[model samples]
Target: MTAMQRLAGFVLVLGFCIIFLFKDGRSQGNLLTGKTVYVWDFATRDGEVNSLTGNFTEEFEEALIQTQQCIVIERRKHQRLFEQRQNEKGIMSLDEISNAEKESLKSLHTNIVVFGDIYDDTEAGQLRIGISVQSFEGEILTKTSVLMPRGKKLDAESRQMAMKELVQKLVSGKDPRPSSEPIVVEVENVRFELKSCKLSGGNLVCTVVITNQGEDRELHIYLPNTRIIDSDAEEYLVKAATIGASAGSAKLVSGVPVKAILTFGTVA
Candidate 1:
């Protein structure tokens, strides 16, 4: 080949090599993997450091998080309303029922959503966390906004507690309620015994034994006020019994050992 042709070939190869190298670098620094993003602060002449709490930084982040959370809450409330419509079916207004009854129904149907708005103060030393909950319908339930003294924090855990409190308050129809401590219930050797029986009267005396298998856990046991769900006559006899004219008797047998004996007779 001629020298001039050889030189031209070398130049072309070099150009291609440079182009390939540039492309590889471009791919590595692509936004998908994350690249340094800079925002021009019109307030600060040319640009400002992208540090939390500067002026644009914390506000921008807080706005983004709030918008995202609002969208999520809106969607959740829509879905919950759909579910409530399905569950209510033919039922219209619950006005006729007792207030207690209406509350019980509401508890079964209502839905709550919790979220957090996180940002930093101007100094960027304190992180601000706003724990809040909303009804599916965009109504604010409970909000506890506090500035946590931390550089960064994950709001998930705090948000969860905030939600739990909100739900409990909403369900109870109370505001400014006391915070709830963690509660766990463990039932061990729960057994039933028949004390007495009268076939014709359909009355049987029965006792329920519930032993605290593990650590102490506060419990509220609802005796069979109505017929036990999906229970046969024999099973119901142990759980429910009617003595004479009285409907039933329930005894709270728990201070430490945690044992309860309920006896009642059912009229046949």
Candidate 2:
């Protein structure tokens, strides 16, 4: 065989080896796997209603177990480990849980932690529970909320339904919060200003100022109805809008300006 033919054969073999290694590395890097989850006790809004949170946590753990999507760590084992750390470090509260302590807990091979707050919605005559699930790296994976009829007697069936919904939402990777960020859209007789913007998790959050120049009138702005147009004529839909803590709708009165935070989820 000619020397050129041998050179060509060597190059072909080298190319095959490189391609095989690249494909192998890509597959190993992108493997999707189940995570080990640790569910902690939920805290009450008033800090006085312990039983409410306890019951909710119990139901939540049970629902998570039934999903068979995660390896749920036992509450007792988690409590013992937490208490051992607290005693050793003189930590008083989980809020005071340091990065070192977090790393130590990660050593247990638990990848996800779920915890939340239970609020007494007295006005609505219901109990509002807000739950957040985070990764061991402290990144919030999802937030969930459940409302149950408030009464002297706890509703077991309602609690079960709520827990099941939360678990299903988590496993499905759906966020209850609005997914779109707010951007200033140019409208006739209206002035739109962007004050600040930030990327939080998978959402773009922005603080904006809106001013109406016309006569005394009420201007209703639906954030989700708004669209962001790029230089390339690509339109991005706004998923959610909020003013202060209140979300969904915002009212702009004539001669009165309003500043509100808007969140937009990244285009999937």
Candidate 3:
């Protein structure tokens, strides 16, 4: 064989070997090596845990572990590390950790941080737990919430089921529910006059009148994250609904008002 043919054969073999190595490395990397997730102890909005908060955290960690997709840093471990860091910094209490410090902690070599709060819904006789998973940079990746109905006692089974659902949704990256929080922006000379808001069969129906108090101007309303807080301070997530008037494309003349009906769903 000619020297050129031998050289071409060697080059072809080298290219095939390189491609094989690259493909193998990519497959190995894609395997479930377990993402490092840290679960912070959930705070209770109504005073203390009352035992439910602690158990919920454990269940959350267990769910992640069972998925074989996460290496969970349990609450106890996280507490110890937090305390150690506080001691090193001469901080006396966990409350002393500023928001910036907390954000820094969440970003510390962790792939995901799961944190949230539990609220006692006194009127409904239930416990509302809101869980959010965030990236190291503090961007929320997914949020799932659950409500455990309380009869005469705390329903442990219901809580477990909620945790399982949350974990499954988190792993699957599907959120059927809308956001619980609202994105509020202040527009000069434009005001929202809430007409009426009522909860009817697990949904909150609300009507608001938007007025252009200053000058004639075109206005757009995008309220994907809009929420309604009841008299009891319970908040519901707003669902997408058609407003009778085109709120998103309303051209309001001076002193004119546009009435829009808004609907929100109860977060479970």
CA lDDT of each prediction against the hidden true structure: 0.31, 0.56, 0.53
- 88-201: candidate 2 lDDT, tens digit per residue: 322212334566657656777877777666767789898766665655554444455756778732878888888898777566653322223433444445556555544454
Per residue, candidate 3 scores C-alpha lDDT tens digits across 1-268 of: 4555334323322232233223322221212236677776565653344466677778777887888876776656556446544323222122334666566565555676676567778899887677755555433344556666766225677667877886775676532222333312224666555444333432445555666687776544344434544323456555643334563345668787666565667422
The C-alpha RMSD of each candidate to the native structure, in angstroms, is 31.2, 20.2, 21.5
Write the residue-wise lDDT of candidate 1 on 72-119 in tens digits.
122222343335332221211122123553343345443433333344
Lowest lDDT sum, 10 consecutive residues, model 1, at 31-40
Candidate with better lDDT, 1 vs 2 = 2
Model 2: per-residue Cα lDDT at residue 87: 22
Candidate 1, position 29, lDDT:
17
What is the number of residue pairs that collide in model 1? 9
Candidate 3 clashes between residue pairs 3 or more apart in a chain or in different chains: none
